[model samples]
Target chain A: MPIETTDIARLAQILENSGVDTIEIEEPGLTLKLVVDTRPRIAASASPAAATAPAADHFVTAKADVAGHFRAAHPWQDKPFVAPGQRIEAGAMLGLVKIGLLYAPVVAPTAGIVDAVIAENGAMVGYGTPIVRILPHAPSNPLN
Target chain B: MIEILSVTGPASIQDLGRFDQYRFGVGTSGAMDDVALRAGNILLGNDENAAAVEIPMMPFRVRFDRNIAFALTGAAVAAEIAGRAIPPWWRSYARAGDILNIKAMSHGARSYLAVSGGIDVPMVLGSRSTQFRGEFGGLHGRPLRVGDILPCAASTAAIGELGIEPAGITLARPNAAADETIVRVIVAGEYDAFDATAQDLFWSSSWTITPQSNRYGYRLQGPAVKPKEPVEKRSHGIVPGVIQMPPNGQPIIQMRDAQTSGGYPKIATVIGADLWRVGQARLGGKLRFEQTAYSDALAAEDEMSAYLDRLRANMRLVEETRTCR
Candidate 1:
C-alpha cells in the first residue's frame, strides 16, 4: 500500500512535538527526513561567502597536540580555563588533555580573544582536534 | 609552617605507616591512599614516605605561615589558594599567609597534601603517622582541629614549575555511571569453609559500601555469606586488606586503621596493589570481587611499582624542563 499524506503529517508533528532538530524514517520504498528550521533570520540575511569570509580570516582554532580526553578546566576547577569572549595572553593555557597519568596543557599560540569553545568538556579528543577558536587581539579592531 | 584555620571533617598527618609496630599491639596508621601520598610527596621532591596531611573529610582550610611549595593528590577535590583554583594532583608554590581551602570531594574519598619537606611533627615509634586509637602520634595523636599550628620544615629543593599535570592518572572512586569496580582478592584463610553457594555469592554478588565505613574498615552490604557449619575462630593477627566475616555475615574489609587482631573468620585478602581502590571507594559505592591467583597479586604489585617509577621519571623530566626554560 502507498503511504498516506496524513501519516507523513503525523510523523512531522511527532518530530516537532518531541523537540528533536531532525528525524529520518526509512521504509521499503520511501525515505523521509524532517528537519526543523532553527537558523535565526540574521544568519540568512548575509550571502554565504560573505558570512564565512570574516570567520575564516579572524578565527583560529586551537587544537590538541596530543590525543586524550579534553578538559575545559582542571577537574578541581569549577570554571573553564578560557571562556568565550575572554581576552587571553600568549602562552596562556586554554585547555588540558589527560592522556594516561599525565595532563598536557593546550596553551594559546598568541594573545587573542576566545571566539568559541569547540570541544565539549570531558570528551575524548584525538590529535589536532580543535578545542577552541580564537581571534587574534588587534587593538584597532575590537570584537563587538 | 602552616596553621590550621578550620577543619570540617577528619584530617590527620600520615606517612607511609608505622611498620614493625604490629607486634607491640599497634596497628599501622597511615594515609589510606598511600599511592596518593607517595605521588604528592614525589611531586614536591620529598621522600616518597614523607608525612603529609590526609584530608578524608573536607572543607579543610589552612594558611601557610611561610612560603612553601606543596602538592595535593589523590581524591579530585576542589582546592583553591587565596581564592584561585589549583589543579588536583599538581604541585605549586604558595606565599606566606595564603589560605588554602580544600572543599568537599568531587570524586574519590581521600586527598593528600604534601609540603616540600613534609609536615614537621615529632616522630613517634619511628613513624609520623597518627595512631588514632592511642591518640599519641601525629599532631598530638588526634585529627587536626581548628587553631592548630603545624610546623613545616624548610624546603631545600627548587620547585618553581607551574601547571604540572598529574597527566593520565586518576585515583578517584569509580563514578556511578561506570561499571562496578572489580577488586581482586586472593582467597585465603578459611575460604574453603564457606559452602559452595556462599562462595559463589561472595564472588558474584555486588557489594555496596555502608555509611558506617571509615578508615578502620568498610562495612559492606550484600548477600550474607554463611559457612558450611558454625565455626568459631580464635582472635589472631590481622592486617589491612583482610576481609573478615562477623556474625552478621556481611564482609568487612579492614583498612589502614583496622585493629591489630580480630576474631572474625577471614575469607580473603585484597592484594597489596589494589588496596588503594578500596581506600578511595566512597560510601554507597558498588564493587565486586574476582578471585585472583597469588602470582597475579605479585605481578600486580610489580606493575604498581613500575607505574611509580614512571611517575618519578616523568616528574623529574618536568622539573628539568622547567629549569631549562
Candidate 2:
C-alpha cells in the first residue's frame, strides 16, 4: 500500500516526540525526510539534503546532496566556484554534481570559511559524500 | 510577476510561432531555440505554447516582484539568484525581492526564461509571439527593454527544482564536421533549374553566416550558385526554413520572422526537425547543407518527439517523488 499523508504525519509526530532530530525513510519511489532545523533557512532542492553535522570548533563539512560526477567548475566555466580560505555564505554553491545532463549543486549549509575541498574534481560521488570542509562562523555565545 | 531590471542584449517574448496568419501575409515569430523553450515550458508544467522571454544576448537581469517558479534553458549562462548559480536547463523557485542576473553565456546562442505561469501577454492571431514586422503581438510587438514589467498567469503549484539533458547535445548528428554547423535539407522547386556543377558547388562549399542575419533570415556568404539561365519566378507563399537564392547567388534561409512571400528562387528547404539547429547557428559561423530524404526527416522528427516524451515522463516522475514524501 502507498503511504498516506496521515501516516507521514504520524511518523513525524513520533520522531518529534522521541526527540529525534532527523528521520529518513526511503522505500522505492517514496522518501520521508524531516529535519528539525535550529534556525530558519531554505534547506534543500530536489536532491537529497546533505548530511550536515558540526564537528570540532563549529567546523562543518558540506557533502553531495545527490549522486553524480563531481565538477569543481561548471562545464561552461573555467574557474572553480569555491576556493580554500574564501568566505562563503549560507546557500552558496561550492561545486556541482553532474548526473547526465542535470547539474545538482553542492551548496554550503552554513556561513563559514572554506577549509578544504574534500572530493576531487571529476570524482564519482554518491549521496552524502563530503565535498567541502568549512569552519562555520563561530556563534557569539557558543552555548545555548 | 517580475520587473526587467536591465537588458544589455536583445530579448522579447515568444511562444510557438503563429501558423494560421501566413495566409493573411503575416510571418511567424517564435523562439529561435524552440526546443529549449518547449522543454522549459514542460518543466514548469506550463502549456507548450506558453510565452517566454527569449534572450539572445546576455547580462540580462530581472527582479522578482512576487514568488514564482521559473526555468532557464538554452545557452549555459551563469544565471545567479541570491548568490546561487543555477545551471542552464534548470528550474527553481525565486522569492519576491530576489534578483536573477544572467551573465555571459558560454554555449548556445539564445536562452529562454519560462515562469511557473507563462508570461501573460495579449495573444494576436492565436499566438503570443512577437510579430516584429506587423507590430501587433508580444509586448508591443518589439524587443524587450529595461524597466518593463511583465505579468504572469496566476499559479500556486508546488515546484521541485530540476534540470533535463538538452536534446541539442544528445540528439545531434555525429557525422558533421567538428567546427561547422550542418543543417539537413531537401531540394526545393528550383533545384532542377540549377546545373549539375552549380548544384555540386552548393552542397560542397561552406557557407558563412553574415552579420545581417536576424529573425528575418540568415544571409549566407559562399561561392555564387547560379542557374544555367536566369529564371524569373512570381512571389509565392513561403515559410521559415526556406533557403532562397537571390539574383546575387547568395542564399538566405528564412527564419521565424521571415516574410510570408518572396520572389527569390528556392534552392532547398531545411527540414522542420533540423530548423532549430539552423536557428541557433551563430553569426559569423559557418554552415554546411546536407541532402536528406523525406523518410529520414520524418524519422528525425520522431526522434525529437521521443526526446520530448521522455522529458515529460521524467518531469512526471519528479513530481511523483515530490508528492510521495
Candidate 3:
C-alpha cells in the first residue's frame, strides 16, 4: 500500500511517541532499515519543528539514515508493498529486513491508497529508501 | 599565486570531504579544522568548501609572488608576513614580494588559512581533499613541501568581525587542560560483543593517546575491553569517529586515513560535529568518553551548520565594512 512520506524528524517524533526502537523492511534485495534513538538520548524538546526540519524526507526515513543500497521487504516474497491499488492504514506493517544481527520491521505511515511501490522488492535500499507511495487522507480539524 | 614555503609540521590542501563513496571504498578526508576553514573562507569571501591549507602544529614558511588576502583560524599560531608579525584568526593583506610564515600552535593542533577567491586546484574525483593512500587529490596527493607553489583565486578580504556577526561555523576545539588528555565518545556498533564489565570500563575509564597516534588513527592506551564473541564478519567501510577494537582489546579511533573496511568490532562512534575534536588531538592527549543521544548528534550537526552559515555571513559583513572604511 502507498504510505505518505514523512520526514525523519517527524518519524522520530512518531517513534518517540510510540516508544518503538527498531524499524525494518525486508523484501529480500530491498532490505532497508533504521534504528532510532540508538545513541544515548541527548535532552531535547519534542518540538514539532525539529521533527520536520530535515533537508530531504526520502533519505531520512525511519530506515537506513546512513547511505547504502536499498533493499526489499522480503527476498523470497512476491512484492515489497501494495501496488497502486492496494490499501494501507496507519501503523500497519510494511516490511522486514535482516541486518548485521537483527530482524527489523517496516511500517506504514498513514491510511492511504498504494499509489505506487517505488522500489523493487528485495532490492538493496540505501539511506532514505522509498518503498511505497501513500495518498494520505486529509486530516480533519475540529477547531476549524 | 600562493607560494610554497617550509612545509611546517603538517600542511596540505583540503576541502569539506567526500561522501556517498562508501561502497567504492573511499574514506571521507577533508579539513581537520572545519570551523577554521569556514572562517578563513568567509574572511576571504570564498566558498566555505573551497580548497585551502590545513596546518597541524609546527611552523611553516612561504614566499608569495603577488599580493593576496588571507585569514588564519582554529589554533592560535604566531604568523608573519615577510617576517613581520601578523595576527592569528584574522585576515591579513599580503603584497606580491611578501612571504608568509606560521609559528607553533598556541592552542589547538590544526589551523586553517583561507585565501580570497580560494585555492585554484583541480578537483580529484569530486573533491580537492588529499587522500594519501589513494595517491590522488590535492597538490599531488601529498603534504605540502618546500618549493611548491599553489594557485589562489581572488576574493574579498573581510567578512565583518569574527565574533560580532553570524557565521555558520562551529569551533570544535577541545577545552584546555593542565594534562594533555580528553577522549569523547558515544557508544555504538556491537557493544554487546564485550562483557558488561568491559562496557563499564570502556565508558567510566580514561585513555591516553599513545605515541603511535598519527593521521590514520589514535592508538588508545587504557583498560582493555575485549569482545565476548569472536567476530569474523567481513571488513566493511569505516569512518573517522569509529572506535574499532582488534583482538588485542585496545581501542583505535579511526581518522581520515582509516581503511575503508575492517572486520574488528566497533564499540562506539564519535558524533559528527565533534569529529574535529578527534582531529585536533595531539600526542598524549587525554580522553573521556561521553554518551550523547542520536538526537543530540543530529542537533549538534544542525547547529554546527548554522554556525558555519553565521560565520560566513559575519565574514562578508566584515569585508564589506572594511572596504567601505
Candidate 4:
C-alpha cells in the first residue's frame, strides 16, 4: 500500500518488520516496487518521525508551455476566465495563448479550485513556468 | 545475502531510473553507467532492472553476511577476497563472513555490484534511484558510506553461473581531436531570436562542459545564443537536454536535476536515450552538437531500445542453458 501519509519514519518501521523485504504495490495501473531493508540496522542510526510535516501551501504560478501571449480569459470574453476558489478539472482550459497566428488553450494539471494567477492577460509565457494552481478538494468518490 | 564490509568513493543505490515524475518538479537521476548496472544484475541471477550499488573509482570492501552470489561489472576494477584476486563479470559464491575487496578502476568511470535479489533499500517516489536535489530517495537520500550494512532478499529462482566477458565492454569518452564541440538542437519555440551570425555560431562552434556541471545541468562555455526576437515570456515546462540560453547567450543543457519548467529560451533538445551518454561525460568533456530531424532521433531511440532488449534476452537464455548443463 502507498504509505497513507508522507511519514518516512513509520514507513521505515513497517518495511523493516514486515519480513516482506520487497513490497510490490499497484494503484491505478501504476506499480510501485520498494525494496524494504530487512536488515533494519542500516537505518538504525536514522531517527524516526523526521518527515511528518505537510507540504507548504505554495501559490500556483503557471507558466506557458511554449512561448506565447497569455490570454486571461476565453477569446469571446474580456473578464478573466477564473477567480480564486473556482473549481477546475484536469485538462480544463485555464486560459489561452497566442503562438504564431494560433490561439492555444492552457489546461489545468490537476483537479482543484483556482488558487492564484501569476501571469496577467496578454503577458508572454515561457517553458518551465506555472500557469495555474488547482487546490484539490477532498475526493467526492475516491474509488472513481 | 552479501554484507558490505567497506565502501569508499561515491556509492549509491540505482535502478533503470526515475521517470514520469518530471512534471512534479523532480529530476530523473539514476545510474550514470546503465550498461554496467544491467551486467551486474545478469551475473547475480536477478532482474536486469534490479537496483545495485554504483561506485566510481572504488576500493570497495565487503564481507559476506551469508552464503550468496554476486557479480561486478564496468571499468577495469580489480577485485580480491582475503587478498586473492577475483575476476570481474563472472559470479562467484562467497561463504558466510568472507571479505571481498575492490581496488581502483583502470578504464571506465563507474562499477556496479549486483547481489542476488538485488540490494535492499526503501524506495521513494516510485524509484530506488537517489535523486539528491529533493533531498529524498535511495538510502536516506545520501551516498552510501562505511559501516552501512546492506541487505539482500532471498531468491527462490535457480542460481545460474555467469560467464562474464570483461574485455568485450566499450566505454564512451570525449573526442580528443575535435577542437570544438557542437551540440545539435532542433529549434523549438524561439529559434528566430538570433541574427544570421549568431545562429551560424550556435551550430559551428564547440562548447566546453564547464567544471560546474552536475546532475542538475551542464553549463556550456561557448558563444552566446540569443533569440532572433526579444520578448519576455512566462515560465513553462522543461525537459532534459533542452539547451536553454539566458540573456547572456551561454547555453545550459539541463540534465537530470532540471526544474519542471523555466522561462529561458530553448533552442534544441537532446534525444532521450542519448541523455545517459551525456550523464557519463565527465566535467571538462567537450560536447559537439549536430542537428538531426526529430524522426531520426526517434528512430535512433527505437534501435537502441531494441538492441538492449536483445542483449537481455540473450543473457537470460545463456543463464538458463548454462544451469541446465
Candidate 5:
C-alpha cells in the first residue's frame, strides 16, 4: 500500500515526539525513512582541543589539553598541520596528541602568525604543556 | 541522513553478519574487514554490532543532511568533509550540508563508515548486512548508488571526537615481514590428499590476490596446488575462510558472500582470528600463509579482544575529559 502525504507528516511528528533521530518503515510496494532532525549543524566548540598558556605580551601559547605523545603530523601523511612562520587562521588545527591508540586533535584558539612550534615531534607532553607560540594578530598590525 | 553524490566500485551496508541461517541457503554477507566495522562502531559509542557502510571502491562522495558524528576505519585513505581533512581511523562530527569525499586508498581493501547511532536500515534475516546475490538485506540488497540517502538512528551517547590507531598496525605477528601479509591457517580435511611438493609450495610461494577476487571469494595466484590424484567430492557445507582448491589448482579463499556449499576440495582454512588481516590485504599485493596450531589461534583471538578492550576504555576517557571541561 502507498503511504499518503498525511501519513508521512504524522510519522515525522511521532518520530520527533519520541526523541528519535530516524525511523524506517517498509511494506508491500513501499519503503519509508523519516529523519526528525536534519538541520542545526553542530559546530565544533571554539577550539576545544588545546588549553591557553601564559605568554609574554603580544604573543599567545597553545598548550596540550591532554597528556600524550605530541605528533606534528598524522602518522599516514607526511605534511604537518602547521609550521613556524605560517599564518594560522583561528580554529586551525595546530597538531595532535596521541593517547594510546587514540589521537586527540590540538586546535588553535586564536588567529596569529606562528612564531615557533615548541613541542618536539614524537615527544611526550603533559596536559597544558606549551606547544606553539603565535604572535597575535591585531587591528593595528600592518601585516593584517 | 547522508546522500551519496558519487561512488565507485561496490558499497553497501554491513554489520557483524547474519549467522545460523545457512540451512536456508543464505550466506553471511558482512564487512570484508570485520575488525574495521567493529572498531568503527566502538569508536562511535554505538553497539559493536551496529551497521556501517563498507566502501571498497574509492572516490566515494556523500553529503550529510544532518549534523552527526561518523568514524572511518579499515583502509588508509585521504578523506575530507567540506574541505577539512579527516584522518584515517578517526571519528569526527559532520555538519549538515558537509560533503565527505574519499579517494582511493594507498593501502588495504575495504573502508568502513560508522556513524553515531549506526545506519538505520530495515534488517533482513536478523542482520542489516547486504546479501548481494540474494538481494534481500541492506539497502535494496545491492550496492549504494548516487542519490541514495542513508538514515542514522539518534545519537544519545556522550562521546568525544577521536581517532584510534589502526588495529592491523597495533596487532603484532611473530616473524612476519613488513612487505608481506602473513595469514595463519589450519589444515582442512582434504589437506593430506595433496602431495608433499604442493603442500610445501603452499607455504613457500607468494600468493597474489587476483583480479577475479570479490566479496564472495579471493582467487589467489601462486604455484599450482593440485592434489596427488583427482579427489572429486560431493558438494559439502562450507563457511567463509575455507580455502578451496579449484580445477585450476590455485587456492580460492571463500569470503563473506560465498555460497553455503561448494564442490571443490579444501586444502586449508584461514583461522577465524586472522581473517581480518586477509580482508584488509590489498589487491595485487603478495600474501603468505603459515600453518598454526589451535591453541596459538586462540591466543591471537585473545590479543585482538584485549586491543578492543583498551579502545573502549580509552574512548570512555574521552567522554570524561569532556565532562571535566
Candidate 6:
C-alpha cells in the first residue's frame, strides 16, 4: 500500500511540533522524510507593507540579520538547508550565518519556491545582505 | 604532512617533554595538555611521546599536503575538513589540499593535532618539544606562522586502513562539578610550616586562575596562606605542579615551562594524573584542591597508565581487523 498525502502532512506537523528539524521513516517498500524549518524570520506583522509590495508577488529576497560567514547547511549535514527550486513554507529556515560561537538562521518571509541561492557557503556576509531568492507560491483553487 | 594556512595565536610543536635536563638548567617545555597529546598520538599509531602540534589558541587552519590519517584531541573545539565536521577525540583521513579548520575551543583550553608517524621536527636535548625560553627546538623554537610547512614522518599505513571513530579513551576529570574543578594534590614536606588557620583555608577556599597564568605557572587568586614565621632558605630544585607559596602568600603552581629551581616554600604538589585538569582549566576558571595521600597519588598514575594500555590494545585490534577486511 502507498502512503497518503494526509499522512505526509501529519508527519510534517508532528516534526514541526516536536522541535526537531528532520525525521525519516522507512517501511518495507517505502521511505519518507519530513523536514520542518524552524528558524525565526522577520515577522509578517511588522513587514506588512513589504509583503504587499508588487515585487512580493514574484521574487522575494531573504536578507541576513547579522554579519558573519554564511552556511547553507550545518557543518555535519550533507545537504543545504534550502536548495534551489525546493518548495518551502512560510517561516521555513533558509540558511545560517555564524558569528563566533553564535549562529543566526535565515527564514522565509512567505511560502514560496526557492529560485536561487545568492550567498555562497563559507562566504562572509554583512547585515541585510541578500542570501536567497524565492518566487511566491501561486494561489490554489478552492474547489480543488 | 600539513601546511599552516593561518594561525590566530601561538601554537608550537611538543611531545612528552625533555626529561633529565633539570641539572643543566633546562626546563621541560611540552604540551600543556599532555593527556590530549598522548591520545592524539595513540589514535594515529604514533609513538606515545611523538611530536604533535599543541594549539592553545583557536581558529587554526592547515591544509593537508598529502593524504594522511590524523587525530584531534582535547578542548572540545569545532573542527572541520573541507567544510565537513569532525568531533573531538576522533580520528579521520584527509586528502591532499583538504583544509582542516579548528575553531575556538568550547570546553577546554588547549588541543593537540597528531598525524600518523608524528611531526618530524629535529630533536634537541633528546626531545622535539619547543623550549620557548631557550628558543632551540621545534620549528625554530617559535610558534607556527602562516605558510609554514612542517614535514611529517613517512608512514606506510594505507589510508583505507584508518577508521573514523572515537578512540574510547578519555583523560578528563571524572564527574567534576560545574564551573569548578577539583584537583588532587599531595602535601609537600614544608606544608606543615603554614599556620593551622592557613592550612584550613587552603583546602576550604576556591582559587581563581588569574589572567597572569600561562605555560610557566598558574598564578592563583585565593586566600593567602601565611607561614607561621619568616624563614630563609637556599633555592632548591622544583618541578611542574609544585605549589609554591611566595612572599605574596598566593600559591603558584609551576607548569611545564616553569623554572627548574625556586626559592619559595612548597606547600603542595599536584599529582601527575590531575595535572591535566589544571592544564585544561581556562583563565578565570575556579579550582579547588583536595589533599590525597602519597599512595593514592601512585594509584592514580597507575590508573592512567592502565587506561593508555587499554586504548593502545583497542587501537591495534581495530587496525588488524580493518587490514583483514
- Evaluate every candidate with DockQ and list the scores: 0.18, 0.25, 0.01, 0.01, 0.49, 0.02
Taking all chains together, each candidate's TM-score versus the true structure is 0.76, 0.82, 0.63, 0.59, 0.85, 0.68
Interface RMSD of each: 3.7, 2.8, 24.7, 27.3, 1.2, 14.0
Tens digits of per-residue lDDT for model 1 on B1-325? 8899878768999999998889988999898988888888877878998999998878999999788899888878888877766677777778888999997787778888899889999999989999888898899999999999888998444454344344224322243334366788999788888988999999988999999998889999998898888669888999999999887789999999999998888999999988987888888888789789999999988877877787788777766766897
- How are the candidates ranked when ordered by TM-score, highest leading? 5, 2, 1, 6, 3, 4
Top lDDT hit: 5
* Candidate with the larger DockQ of 2 and 6: 2
- Docking tier of model 1: it is incorrect
- The digit string of per-residue lDDT tens for model 3 on B1-325 reads 7777677565788888776676699887888757667767766667778888888757687776666777777666767766644444556677787888886765556877777777888988788888877878889998888888888875343332122121211333345354443444678778878898988888877788898876678899997788887777687767788998888888898887777888889999988887776676667767777778888788878877777666555445545655797
Q: For candidate 1, write residues A16-97 as lDDT tens digits.
A: 4334568777889888887876666796666577767866887777887755678898765678899998988776678888
Q: Among all windows of ten consecutive residues in candidate 6 chain A, which has the lowest summed lDDT?
A: A11-20
- Lowest-scoring 10 consecutive residues by lDDT in candidate 1 chain B? B167-176
Candidate 4 per-residue lDDT, tens place, A57-140, comes to 533444455445777763323456567778766655577665532344566767667887766677656444466756665567
lDDT per residue as tens, model 6, B1-325: 7899989767899999998788999999888888778878877778889999988888999998787888888677788877756655657778878999998787778888899899999989989998888888889998899999989987435443222222122344675676788899999968889988999999998999999888889999988888998646688899999999987788999999899989898999999988887888888898899999999999988877776776677667656766797
Best by DockQ: 5
Evaluated at residue A38, the lDDT of candidate 2 is 39
Q: What is the TM-score of chain B in candidate 4?
A: 0.80
Q: Quantify how close model 2 is to the true structure by its C-alpha RMSD in Å.
A: 8.8
Q: Candidate 2's residue-wise lDDT over A23-138, tens digit each?
A: 78789988878876534355545444444432444679898766668889765567898999998888787888876556678889998889999889997776677889898877
Docking class of 5: acceptable
Q: Across residues B1-325, which tens digit of lDDT does each residue of candidate 5 receive?
A: 8899998988999999989698999999888888889899988889998999999888999998878899999988889878877878989888778899997697788899999889999989899999999998889989999999998886444345578888877895777675578999989999999999999998898999998888999999987889999989999999999999988799999999999999899999999888888888878887899999989889888888888999999888877877797
Q: Given candidate 6, what's the lDDT at residue B102?
A: 95
- Against the true structure, candidate 1 reaches a TM-score of 0.76
1 against 2, candidate with superior TM-score: 2
> Where in model 5 is the C-alpha error above 4 Å?
A1-56, A142-144, B155-159, B174-179
Off by over 4 Å in 6: A1-144, B155-175
TM-score of chain B of each: 0.94, 0.97, 0.89, 0.80, 0.96, 0.94
